[model samples]
Target: MKIILSTLNAKYVHHALALRYLSKSVPDARVMAFTINHTVESVCAELYKKITTDTLLGFSVYIWNVEMTLRVLARLKKVAPQLKILLGGPEVSYDPFETLTANTFVDYVIYGEGENTFKALCNANDCVSLHSIEGLAFRQDGQVIVNPPRPLIQDLDTIPSPYTSAELAAFEGKMLYYETSRGCPFTCSYCLSSTTHGVRFFSLDRVLADLRAMLDHRVGQVKFVDRTFNCSNVRTKAIVTFLIQNAAQTNFHFEIAAHLMDDALLALLKSAPTGLFQLEIGVQSTHAKTIQAIHRQTDFEKIATHVKALRQADNMHLHLDVIAGLPYEDYEAFQKTFNDVYALKPHALQLGFLKLLKGAAIRDFEGYTYCDCAPYEVLATPWLTHAQLLALKRMEDMVE
Candidate 1:
């Protein structure tokens, strides 16, 4: 029962689209994806030369590779003590029994949205079919058993396309993650998509036949992982007027909500073409009490009048973001939220620093202080200090 699927990616052109939707519902699962620049003894000596002891292996954890995927599954279960770990996204899907009681060599996790609980746990074989697999979380006699969560998959075109044609030749120069949508009309309390609630969609003829099969494999970039991708202005002008009428050189990143732009989607993204669209937005703090203490529903003057009308229509690629230590932001109110997002002249600005993740809603807010592990960042807050978050990390290293 091999079933492998993995993830570590923080670079090398990033690709694990949820291990290609859990390898299209476990069709003899085997994915592998690695990146946090490898080491953990070279990814457990290449997964101990392709696993055994009845394999299982799954991973896909987050918060930038959950502490190197728990030190590469605690050194691959101390060199394969009958191999069979497992864990799933959103950093162990919000505490699956405190992630199997502090990772006892994680024998299972598969919380929310893991393609029908990892294809009913690779077609379960015993323990009374793992107690009827519903977003499982394992261990028994020594108790852990999390079950009962697997709901959110309302026919997202019955989850399939991980772009076949042998996965678009393993997506040549990487960057090709696409998703027509999935929950986030706005809950924004330092997002984990605000502990999931609404939005779903996948049919606009299954998103223009999955962007006409990644613009007929011209795939240089696609990146829509939809946290908001314009939260539906008729599917953002029919997917940006079908990627400006069938994207020629691909290029298409998203993450939008710039006060929900319009004026006919900024005149169809000011008639695209110059580096065909990029966007990104997230102005995390212009400090109206740190955007009402992070329930962030922005309007920063209509995001500075639609990022100064898409930077004077210099043809797309905006990128703005902010975040430095929230809840009434300090250090002189984050320098006026970084000079009001650096006077919106963004072609890219970022400067982020607040992380407090693991089931976010601002980690139940109250005088912050973080880094208890895997990117729980903040480190000082009764109105910011830790030497002003190390002088906002040396002003984010001189604004990169």
Candidate 2:
């Protein structure tokens, strides 16, 4: 059987770690990655024509690529109806039955962390065998069958890096993704991280070795996919100290909570070699009501102080983020949020609009309306009018 793993990334420079993990789990299968913005049509055409009837194509779905992937799946089915299609990731995991029944082209969906489930699925003999695989959702005799959820991988280290020589060769001048840990400790309402229960760490030894390997290969950049890198101070310091001690040429980036930074953490980061570390901190909003509404915690004063302190080092590149169209954050309020984040003189200011993702708390809450698209971005809220939201979007574009 020819099993092919595919995904549509947000950009050409971005690489999806989920695809890599699934590929690593099934070493024999080939991986085909594509970007969402440009060449999507051409890519769909190419895959539809090149794939044979015997091929089994699996797509990694995301809020950004759900529509594009569906389009591709539809076209591919018309060309090769015998081809089997599989879907996975957080987007499909929430409503697998509806997705499977609504789209006949999708043969199956392996929800959640798919490394183990996907491995079992690829080895299945027939449709009957597919029923035995745990954590799967499929259609059997015109009825959708949703199997029990798969347990999270207790030992994250068991899943090896997807960085085979052939895989690494494909990302030559592109970005690389590394996960030092899984799950986030915080329960931010708008984030999917809340669904995850506990934090699990990869062995520090394994992480150091992986870091060394990436440094040896000298990839463009390695971005840690961990939701919150500094959630655990011990692990954070260990990893940071290793990077500082190793002192390689490759750049490492992480998304961390700025308010969580203590003097010790700041001291550790302040001494890093210039260009070795880049940090992205999500300061979603400055308004207290919005922050509380979204269940997001931030010590603005502490964050400002820590951020400014790190900037003096001239080594750390801090990227501060602000979200527009959030609860109780009107245009004027978002303007204040933007101005507040801007005052920090961050290397980059990421102005993001609120996306009411599936399973996020905002979806269950009231007072918001959003587009019914893949990235269900907020169209308007009681606090922020549609015109105000559009104005903020324009300002964000200009700021970027």
Best by TM-score: 2
Q: Which 10-residue window of candidate 2 scores lowest in summed lDDT? A: 165-174
Candidate 1, clashing residue pairs?
370-379
lDDT of 1 by residue, 1-400 (tens): 8878888899978788888877887788988888998898998899889998799898888898888889888988998989988888897888899989988888888788888888888888897898889889899778888878877888889898777866776665457888888889888787898788889888889788877877776778889888988877867898888888876887889989888887888878888888888888888787787787677777889888988988898887888888888887778878987898897779779798888888888889887889898788988988887997997898888877
Model 2: CA > 4 A from native:
37-41, 169-173
RMSD of each: 17.0, 1.7
Worst lDDT run of 10 residues, candidate 1, spans: 165-174
**lDDT computed for candidate 1:** 0.84
